[model samples]
Target chain A: MGDHLARAEDFENKAEKKLSGWGLFGSKFEDAADLFDKSANSYKLAKSWDKAGSTYIKLANCNLKLESKHEAAQAYVDAAHCYKKTNINESVSCLDNAVNIFCEIGRLSMAARYLKEIAELYESEQNIEQAVVYYEKSADFYENEEVNTSANQCKQKVAQFSAQLEQYQRSIEIYEDIARQSLSNNLLKYGVKGHLLNAGICQLCKDDVIAITNALERYQDLDPTFSGTREYRLLADIAAAIDEEDVGKFTEVIKEFDSMTPLDSWKTTLLLRVKEKLKAKELEEDDLT
Target chain B: MAASDPNKLMAKADKQTRLSLTRWSADWKSATVLYEQAANGFRVAKDYENAKIAYEKASKGQEMLSSPWDAAKHMESAAALAKDLRHWQEVVDFYRRASELYMECGRPQPASDALAKGARALEDSMSEEAIQLYTDACTILEDDGREQMAFDLYRAATNVYIKLEKYTDAASFMLRLGLAADKCNATNSQCKAYLNAIVIYLYAHDFIQAEKCYNDCSQIDAFLRSDQNRCASKLLAAYRDGDVEEIKRIAQSSVISHLDHVIVKLARKLPTGDVSALKAEDEEEALDENDLT
Candidate 1:
């Protein structure tokens, strides 16, 4: 009985080989279909899932030869699932193939579901970056599916990660430089002011003017509206520090400030400072007389 | 008075008058002979002014006597004397006179000879200042339908243009030279003009036009059996547009046999990739093959 079973298995293998060759070469639709079905059944009964999947793939190819696209796609999906049970790598590859096939067949949502499944798998692996990258790819694919809020959320995640990455990289350099300078100078008023100014610029890069002002006040007082002419105000601040009591010098600073057209609030505050210093100097001279 | 005695006195007076006439004829003949001697002496002494005057008087006297040979000879002598004295203007005048006399005397060869001499003298001593004279001579020759001689003057003018690098003018004259040579059945000179045109176009680097000229030269050389390598070289140089390898192939394969020195210089200046190692590898392979052998 065992010899008879072995003979039966040899006969099935020979029949499968003949069927595969016939499926490749036979031009008639009925013959090709019959051969492919025989090969697929033989592979399935032999417990060779990989070979079974390939036979199903060949069956799908035969369907494509017959221009039976719907049957071909079903056969490909079945083959993909068969490969999935054996290897996750093959499963992802087959899933990608099915997604492409679904996209080609204009079943974009089905294609997107396959992409989401892949992204979720990556996400479960804690490979959020790769998941985000694939999610962005799926969003591009579903850009026409406007009602798909999932794709929109994916796009938003991409933007949020991109901005966060840029901000993180920029903060590293900016904070390190500020910390080093502050330590070495012992945070003197002028040194603290320099650090604050640098920190303000960094905050501005981050679009956080509140943080910029808080940083600035650690060294010196910061005027509101320090957006456009902050550099000019800093120059005036330096001039005031150097010669605090000279009304003529303060008047010159005010004149220099006035010469700039379209002044921002920073320049306005600097002008006011110059005026107050000049007034204080005049009052002191009057007292001396 | 007796009749015989009066007749005798009249005869005697007639005899005396005849003797005086004879003496005067002799004196006139002697003076004519002396003028001939003086003209020949002045000509031999290189005194063209005196020779011209003496020859003029001798010619007149011979004309009065209806001595055509004497008149022709004296006029020819005067022309020769003027030519020998390098008096070109007077030489042309004397030559014209001599030619007219020779033609009148029915010596057409001598007239033709005298005219040719005058034309040659003008050509030899011709200067830029004498352009009008040259033009006049050319006009006369052309009006007489002597285009071959006119082409000589044209060629001379072309030489002036060549001196000035007026290639277009030189080419124009060269074309005229070809036409004149064709008219005169002078194939050799026509071929020379065609060759000259090819050279001009080659110098101008006008290859397309030069190719046409080269074809003409080739056709001429076919019958003349002359080597056209020089012209072919020029054509190659004008038509060549690439590096030395292409030029070398063309020069080697075409009728042109010589390599251009400029091409050689340029090839030397071109950066050659170092291939000695590659060649060494080939040599090693050859050595290995020999060892196996």
Candidate 2:
């Protein structure tokens, strides 16, 4: 490792010397960039991530000096990969550099792609807030470029994490919006039910009766067939239980639901929360009566 | 010797038990799902009662799994069905329950939001009930440090009181609102609350209370003192002189007038210095005071 680092330093010196040599601007800068790239490769081979990152950054600088912004961005991206192994903050900074260069060069897709990568990196690190931010940024770019699928995919991920973090209202809004979009498009109509159900479920986390009623009415009218579906029925029954303050009734309805199909844990958790409240209300009602 | 092949029989029995257990679980799951579907079918058929019951059953499935949020969603669904049925009491109860669930889940804001819905569901039904729910909601929001939400709810309750011709009740709520607004340094709202209290008190024919609220409101709001001091003084003068006609004319022409025309007209029709209505109002106030004590 030491020998490889020494070799990297030697190559870096040669790159600097080349930059000061009497040659054409492109040739001299390219030579320097090539030598720096070799140094970065050597550092990487030696498993010296910090050294490799710095070398790649130097290579990027050489490319920038030559006014080859695209090449500079690629070098920055390479530097980010090296930085990922040793320093997360540096990795983020490198990725940011690449994004800035890519955006400046009108490579919006590239910028967006890097942003998604950053989001994924943050997700893997369990920095959910940062992950949401980067995913939103990526979604924004993709949306701007008319890449509907990519934008929606990133948005779906954001919605998923938002819900997991208990930002239920926001997740609900996002899912409903997606559902509406799907409902409007013939190709995507088939997927609307899933989104609508998700939104309806999230509505349970909110106390907006008007909104819930509006959503129900909207869903009922969306298709006559939808109203007959199990999802709609479950939501309707739950709403009834809430209104009646009947824990026993609520329990019976839910029990009936479980007997038909298994519930995912997330759905189960929210349902139980509603049930507990109903029981409390029942107790209060008993006292009132 | 008689228990020969005991291991083989035990193995067979164990296998039978495991198979039945799996089947039982599957049956439970399917039945639960069928109830969910049946609820939806009933909703589609506009059979609200059946839908409400079905949702309750679905929620029970979630409860068995100990899923709080999911269970809460079922109650929300039931509430929706009840709303469709125009059953205000049921809607309020469901929302109340949902709020508790949200609170239990460590989400106070959603808890308060659920109460807000409950309050709304009660709004167009029974005014007294609505007022109570709104008060409950405001208290929750206030305890949660959501001063703005609390203030909004109290204001809403006061409006409802006014609409119901419960002038004295409105006056009390407005006074409470003024105090809350003062604490938040919401000068405009504080002054407005005090002003509203003054008007409501006068409409209720509680002259002494009206004068007191007027003075208190003027002290807190310079704009009132600056713009409507003359109006207040003239009304007081008419009241003191026992000139019922003058009182009616001045109150009608006052800048701060635009109070409930019905109450003002009713006040005008009463005999001079009779004050029977005022006495009735005082008794109500006394009853409220006793309750507080």
Candidate 3:
């Protein structure tokens, strides 16, 4: 009878060996998880947390393959707890994996808890932002943790988050302060008059007359002796673009030219021509009057 | 036994003895005197043949002394004797010898004179031979790089070419004359040659090629003004003729800025009827009659 049973079970035994071989090489997590889980209970009964954790990791991987997000997260959490007694680092690493999986599954609150744990572990290892981030999440998970009072861990997480936020804000402030100092140095080296004139032109283009005036005022303050011919010309162009009678703009152009100590003869001639034309227009206006 | 008779007889005896002695010694001076005396005696007797023989002996004696001038004189006498004797070849030979000796004496002018006389003698009998002689003489001077002499030769040759109505060959020689002038850096001569070439082309009615030569001459600094005027006039005439070739020629020629300005001015004036005056002046010329009509 034993010989007959061995013959009948021969194919079944071959199939099991082939399945295990396929599990090792096939990269199919579902197949590998089924094979391991079938053997996991035995390992668990044998009080093998290591094997159980390994099987749970494989189960979590299989659940990931099936896109069963909650099950995969839970499995990774169980694996982390199992690995915790043996190696905290390995447990944190497993928790990291669980956090990532939970995040992918829209389990932000769970990911925040894992982040807090990882942050605490890293902070203890002197990682600041990571601890701050987990601390921030602990606050987010306050209602989710379902405790009567906030845990001390949660409270510590909040304080740390607050300190980290202040540190970050101070860092931003310091960056802005340094930027302002560099800008001032640049202005001292190469006068900001040209920059302000350019800013005035930009503001004029944007129809920001007040900003243009402010920039022009700043430009004059920086460069008191600046010739405003180009600015006056731009103003005239803007006035013309707006279909305004811009004799004042032209007058400003002439004033800018006249302000020079040794006026360009060509410019003087051109200004005389403009003045003559204005005189002719004024005479015609008087005749109309 | 009178003094005069004895003296005369002694003189006679001395003469006879000197004559015998001169015959024995074969002295050239005595021989010349004897020969002259014999020729005079023969002439007195009208013995023409002996007179000739006496002159021959004198010539032979002179030749024996190896004096070139004397030999040439003797040879000339021989030629005269041969001419009298109607020995034409001997006459030629003697004249040739005399000429050769004169040339050997570095007497080119005399040698040339003798050669010309010789050539004249041969001219009717062998005109081509006379020409060949002249050509040979010219080659000698040419080989010596005597340009003036060569130019004379070329002029002579050009005359010959013209006689033959070989104008192309004449022009070619004229071109050589120009080349010689160019080698001497005679810009005016080069310009003249170029002008002559233009004339040749124009006579051939090769207006385009004539214009090309004109332009080339114009580029020469020596002829610039004349060539410019010539070329511009030709261009204006060509423009009137509607000659596409002449127009193309002018277009390929140098651009005179002033002329371009004038043309532009004329173009501008045309619309206002201002160019009519210029047109009327052009019409007055006989060449523009066709256009006017």
Candidate 4:
């Protein structure tokens, strides 16, 4: 690591000297860019991510000076990758720079990919709101390029995070729409049951039994085969359980489903919340009686 | 075991095992064991065709024994053998069957994964069907509240559509994506989708549709305040006014520049004619002529 660092510093010194003593009509920036590139690689080898990132930035500046927009953008992307281990915010900023340059150069797909990387970084940092923002941007870029599948994936993340934020309505709507779109495609037909189930669950979370019932019915209409699935039965039974104000039945239904197919924590949490609401209602009714 | 040649005997034995399962009194365990042994023998002989058949028989026996997961695994093996033989259709069918078996056992994640794998296997040879599989896989995961896992499936499907130049379908999907994003309260994504749709419309020279998209987006409070909305509205106004320079100016603006590459390219191609206003003028002229008549 020390040996690499020494090499990096030496290269940096040479780049500075070359830049400072620029001869007329010489490709000074190009030569400096090459030196800086080597310096950045050495820094990376030394595991000095911050230094590598900064060196790449310098390289990008040189590339920009030489009117190499694509290389400048690429350098920025490389810089972002290096910064990712050391400073997430810096990495994100570097990526943002790369995305802008990519877009400027009409590399929409590349820009979109970088936008996704930015979203992922924010996601890892637990900055959900920011993550959604970038995911949305990337999804849009992907969509504009006729990359529906990629866009859908990003949209799914946005939906998932929003659901976590208790934006149940929005989450439900997105799932329902994607589900509906999937139905027309033969390969996607099998997934309709799962989508409707998620939408049904989101509906249940609103704590309106009638609305949940209506949504379930709407889902049935939307996907004719959904009524035959285990997911449908589970949602229907839960809705019945909630409507009857039977906390026991609700628990029983969840337990029955859990036995057959384990529910993830997200579902478990949402189901528990529904169960709590049911319990609250049951107690209120008993008091009135 | 080698009375008639082991490979031929194994192939014949798997067929007989499949045929013998007609009666309820037949023992599925013995049949499954025999099929597995035959499949292994065939695989050892490098006879993938017979191995695939034997695995299918084994999968059927497992299904009869009420072990859908094991059945799915056997079916997956059959699918893999079929893939090795380059039987694309059989690979898809086996994967679908395996996925169904997994779904029957209430393991949606694996079920979805199986379909995705099938899609991947078919991607090079049969892109259209691969997209179908991908879409199915994504839908399953999304429905199961595992949308996070289905992300790549969506991306793969989109890439296929773009490769096929199904721009209209892709654009419609983008609109749907926007709506989904809107539901998630992802303001930026929603704005981008709306703007993207408009750009696609403009790219297609559907100026009237672009205007309609702009008007629709302007209704949303978040979009109304978004930079994307600002960029879209400016471009639309420039189109209406037939201000070529203004269109050029907006298209080159930092805001538009930061948009997706496709949108940027489309924006650069926006017609300088009075597309929206000309239609309005023609409509007005028609009304005036009708009144005179």
Candidate 5:
């Protein structure tokens, strides 16, 4: 590590000197970039991420001086990966710098791709706020690039985390919009039923009796075929139970739905929220008695 | 020429619609008027689908003519037809179109009103849409310097969270309401918001946040002098002692319950049946889980 650092300093000092044609004022970034790249590789061999990362950053600067935008962005991305091993915030900053360069060069697709990497990194770190921001950016870029599948995939992540953050309306809107687009294209139209069901669950929590019933009719309109699906019926039954203020009926309806297709924990948690309203109503009734 | 002849009326309306559209390519005002007449003709003939289509056509023509108010009206008519047919998504879309038209006219109040109608219709079944409509309306109003309306809408949003049993979030929103109220010199509203925040935080079993809420509320003149606030102090003492009945007494006291119905309901669910030692039991359970893990 010490030998690599000494050699890296020697390269950097030489790289910083002024160039004057012929021998380039006794300096040449082409050699300097090469030397920095070597130092970075040696640091990687020694498993010193900190050293490798900084050296790669220097190499990236060298690549920038050579007017190789793509190479410069790639080196920055490499540096980000090395920084990610021990210091996540540093990794994020490095990746942001790379993305900025890519964005500046009109390489939207590449920028979007790296943005998704950053989002995934944030997700792994449980920095949900940052993850949502990057995912949203990636989704937008992918959508602009006509990469529909990747855009929707990123949108799903945004929706899921938004729900986790208790921003239910934001999550529901994303699902509903994507589902409507799918229905119109007759592409995976059958999937709209689940999306409507998720929207219903979000609605059920909102304490708006008006919105829940009205949503049922709207779902039928959004995806006419959804009206006949098991999930649709399940949502209807739950809404009915809410109207009746029947906890037993609500539980039974949920059980019946699970029988059709077992409820995952996420779905169960959502149902529990609906059941909470029922609990309060039942208690109020008990108090009256 | 019989007024009650449905088939003839439909035929005449359709012909006029085709002629007006084909012949009046350069005159949008006339086209809009003709389309509206056609829409009414179709409505009289009980041809709802065609009526909606004609109304939509009229809306488009009016929009092109830069008559946004007229465009919004036609779109609203189309929305009514769609609503009658139970085409709820179309209803929402038409309302959104109307709102957008109003926005194009630089009429924020009418735009907000249009969204509120959509919010009302969707609030029962699609709360997310309802919330979005309300949020968008509030954003427009807020940007237009209608801070009172914005604060009220935010409070409404928090009320929805409370109904959903999301106490921590409800409290956070209430805090926002309190801050906004303070800025506007709505002293009573400010204290109510802060007290509401404290109750919600207490319900959430987050003592630190509840204390912070209490401190904030205590500074408010309305809270300092009110009977409810006095009861709230007693309620806090009950909570510390884990006295379920004492907590209930203070909560159910006449003055406190009227301040917020949702809080009492939330408090009912707060009791764990073993109120002897609050923090110790939870900590021990945590340790037990950690050991298992």
Candidate 6:
């Protein structure tokens, strides 16, 4: 580690001298950038994350001075990775800088990928609201670049978090839109039923049985294969069960569905929310009578 | 008797026991000695099945000889073998039997320990039975004038009830724990138990019960002076006034947030829906109108 640190310092000093040295036709910036990159790598080898991150920033600055936007963005991304374990705020800011540079350089795909990375970082921090915002932006960029699969991935995250925030309408719309979009592509068609199931579950969270029934009908019409899927059957059964205020049948349907294809935690949380609503409804009716 | 092998020793012990049973005058003392020796030999050989049986027979013989402490020791050995075999029900039974034997010898602490251990062994497979054993153990400690020792047992039972989603039962157990804590003069534990009970009741949407719990806790001198008491009073007031924002504020307040995670979670879930709270308010208004008339 000590050896790496000394070598890193030597590289940094060389880079600084190159930056200040008179050169032919501004060739010194490129030399400085190369030396800074080496310094950053050596610092990374030493496990001095803070020093590595700052050296990468210097490399990014040199790349910017050399009018190389792509290299500058890559340098920022490298810096972000180095800072990720040490400082979340610094990492996020670096990624933001990288995304902006990628966008400015007409690299929309790279910009969208970095945005998704930012959303993931926020999600890991349990800042779901901020995560949703970045994911939405990433999804928009991915959609503009005609990358439907990656866009849908970000859209799913946005929908999941929106549902957790009790914004059922927003979640249902995203899921329904994604389901509609996926139905046309042969490779994406198989996942349409799952998307529809998530949309229906969001509708159920609103505690509106009629809306859920209508949405189920719309989904069945949108994809001919959807009504045949287990996701479809589970949603239809749950909608009926909740309509009749039958908690036992609701549980039984969920149990039966889980026995075949296990529900994920997101689905389980949404279902529990629906169940709690049903219980509240039951208690209200009991009180009225 | 000179046989060094476990199998041979067990065989000799069995033969001697059969001979004693058949005789008009039973040689109980020699039978007991042979059973203990065989049990130890089987234990050394790692033959738990034979060891457990030998220990049970030895325990029975010791009981007949009016040596209850020795009987308890053998029963404990049988219970250990049952645990090693993963026979959970048998483990519970043997330990319970050992606990009873220990109690007969006037050793309440060991009796309680035996019951608590049995409860822990059965907690996963048979939670209700575990709760029963835990409660019995707590009662033994309480009767033996060790109220502080019973605190964790009460807490364990409450946690099991909470896991089972029996919130009312959990709250009741928390109140009992509060009483136990109070008797032991453990002021912090008493306040926490009372506060947890109130939060649990509110989480279960039993505002009436929550209010009742708050009123009861406020009568305790230690609880009345505690920060938990103030939190509970504010929460109840928020519920009574049907103030959703106030409830949320109280849930996130420093006092409530610094409590147990389970209690914090329950506080955060304090019902925001107006249905139940509105209904309670309506009833209160009607009562006030009647009083005015």
Candidate with best lDDT: 6
Specify the poorest-scoring 10-residue window by lDDT in model 2 chain B: B1-10
Ranking by lDDT: 6, 4, 5, 2, 1, 3
Candidate 3 lDDT over residue span B100-178, tens digit each:
7666656555454444444444544544444444454454454445444444444444434434445455556656655
Per-residue CA lDDT of candidate 5, range A1-289, in tens? 6786577556545554422234563247677777778778777766789878988898888788787778899999999999999888878888888987776554668989999999999999999999999999999878645577799889988987887777888988998888865653323555667778888888887767788889888886555445557888888888888888889998998888798699878778877877987899899999999
Interface RMSD of 1: 50.5
Question: What would the per-residue lDDT of candidate 4 be over residues B1-293, giving only the tens digit for each residue?
Answer: 46324355455545554544465365677767677766756654567798798889889989989999999988987997888899999999999999999999999998998998788778779989998898888778767766546545654565466457675655665665566566667677678778877877776667878888788778889989999998888887776666777777776676764444345555666663446575576678779988954
DockQ-based CAPRI category assigned to the predicted complex of candidate 5: incorrect
DockQ of predicted model 6: 0.01
| Shift of residue A80 alpha carbon in model 5, Å | 1.4
> Which lDDT tens digits does candidate 6 get at residues A110-170?
9999999999999999999999999999998786455778999999999999999999999
TM-score of chain A of 2: 0.82
Q: What is the TM-score ranking, best to worst?
A: 4, 6, 5, 2, 1, 3
- lDDT (0 to 1) per candidate: 0.53, 0.72, 0.50, 0.80, 0.74, 0.85
User: What is the DockQ score of candidate 3, to 2 decimals?
Assistant: 0.00
Highest TM-score, which number? 4
TM-score of 1: 0.29
DockQ of 1: 0.00
Which residue segments of model 6 deviate by more than 4 Å?
B1-293
- In model 3, pairs of residues that clash are none
- What DockQ, between 0 and 1, does each candidate earn? 0.00, 0.01, 0.00, 0.01, 0.01, 0.01
Displacement of the residue B121 alpha carbon in candidate 4, Å: 29
lDDT of 2 by residue, A133-183 (tens): 999999987864546788888898898788777798888878877875565
True contacts kept of each: 0.00, 0.00, 0.00, 0.00, 0.00, 0.00
The Cα error of candidate 2 at residue A245, in Å, is 3.5
